[model samples]
Target: MTTGTSKAGMMMELSHDSTLRELTTDQGVLRYHEAGDGQPLLMLHGSGPGVTGWRNFRGNLARFSEHFRCLVLEFPGFGVSDPADGHPMATATDAVGRFLDGLGLHQVDVIGNSMGGFVGTRFALDNPDRVRRLVTIGGMGRNFYSPGPGEGINLLMEFTENPTRERLVQWLYSMVYDPAMVTEELIEERWAQATEPDTLAAARRMYGKAAFAATAAAAARSEEAPLWAMLHGLRAKTLITWGRDDRVSPVDMSIVPMRTIPDVELHLFPNCGHWVMIEQKAAWESTVLAFLTRKDAA
Candidate 1:
């Protein structure tokens, strides 16, 4: 792991190397990207086919690193990190806990995208005192108006079941308000990563038709309450950001957390979709930095 003792030192290191660091935990030897030096900020990525921590948050990391020590954690089963046993979400949630514990970081400010947001919220609820602030970008709430498994998700499931460049392109297009964002290079990169033997297998376990049905059936059988119902138990100061036109996890999903979390705020970005931080980069970063830096209201 590299540390930036001076501004120039930090910039030089970041500019030269994009290498990720590793931390050994009971879950596995988890991988992550670390930058800056200050209050710890744990960043988690979404659980989409071929998605990685770098791909999800690279745009905002530099700016965020300026003020906080940003750690973009690579969840298990995502190809970048060693895969762990169990359902993907359960393994992911456990991986987050193990990551923090491995780093000896008791408390941190967390920003999670989609599935990551769900994991972060679950962690915060289960261990309230360990989170100071929480920020989630879409996919963190229960669907109220929109149907479950939104449009983008259906496309994603299709891609996982039958890996294809065309299907990936379709899903990528659905992720944003503008189709222009899905560039050829992005498609090629995602296709290469998404179709890797083990990675593709992992994706199937999480999003394939049978896997989805099994997950739904398991949830139905479980007696425990869902994450949305546990929102009130999250003690961290929270900020929820969503793309007004999100097709994956629709904007309406934010409603439950908006009404429940004791200390919470929500921002809806126009002309954006599931990838809020990427589609609305500057504005999202500015808003998040302000929230992270601002003193609590007296």
Candidate 2:
């Protein structure tokens, strides 16, 4: 076996206590971290080079797991999941659909951050019956703009052997209110994931081509009119939460979606950034729990 596989095996062994499992889907066998028991809640992570479900939802897992079956999916080419043969973004929506089918979950509360948010919205639109409720955090793809130089540079450095920790911290700090929250352990974990031999090349390819291309294509198709129209058509109760200080997908972009959806509610947390769940875990959990447990939502 390759060094990457050996390292992954070790990581899996260490994470066994977390109830992590490998689930086969159409795209590939995905490594997922699952917890809790009740109504199903599917969590999708952002599309950062080395992003995973754990990194996106780590801080809020305990609270959410208490009330819902929380399944954090590691997308193909990210975390421990092997790369898909086709274009990753093109096949992702179908992969998610197959995953839900494989699990025999008719409907689920879908929560996604960043790129996952984009996919969640698309999935809801494509398979309304499969999504009971939709929640997106700092979502992208609604608008089409090139990733700034800083973002491009960060994506490139993530694949390097010695990814600059300081740069990574800076990038994360820009995504949250308190830079101090970017702990050493968190940084190290992110570094390790980014540098993992199995995923590094795939990550670079995603950043360079599939990610932005897919986002642009999706945005062009949705535009403002179509996206709003789709939001209006959604039967599921929707909750839109955004960070007041979100520099990535600004709070302004969320306003139209909140107003367009008939049964939608919006929450903008102050002193927060793109990663609101991590930046304001308590408030985020309470808000989500209250929304999901509402009479109309149930």
Q: Which candidate leads in TM-score? A: 1
The lowest-lDDT stretch of 10 consecutive residues in candidate 2 is: 1-10
In model 1, which range of ten residues has the least summed lDDT? 10-19
On lDDT, the leading prediction is 1
Q: Each model's C-alpha lDDT?
A: 0.89, 0.70
Can you write out model 2's per-residue Cα lDDT over 114-208, one digit (the tens) per residue? Answer: 76877788888878888888887865324334343334234344434344666566666667777787788877877778767666666555555
Query: What TM-score does each of the candidates earn?
Result: 0.95, 0.80
- Candidate 2 similarity to native, TM-score: 0.80
Model 2 pairs whose backbones collide: none
Off by over 4 Å in 2: 1-16, 140-166, 209-229
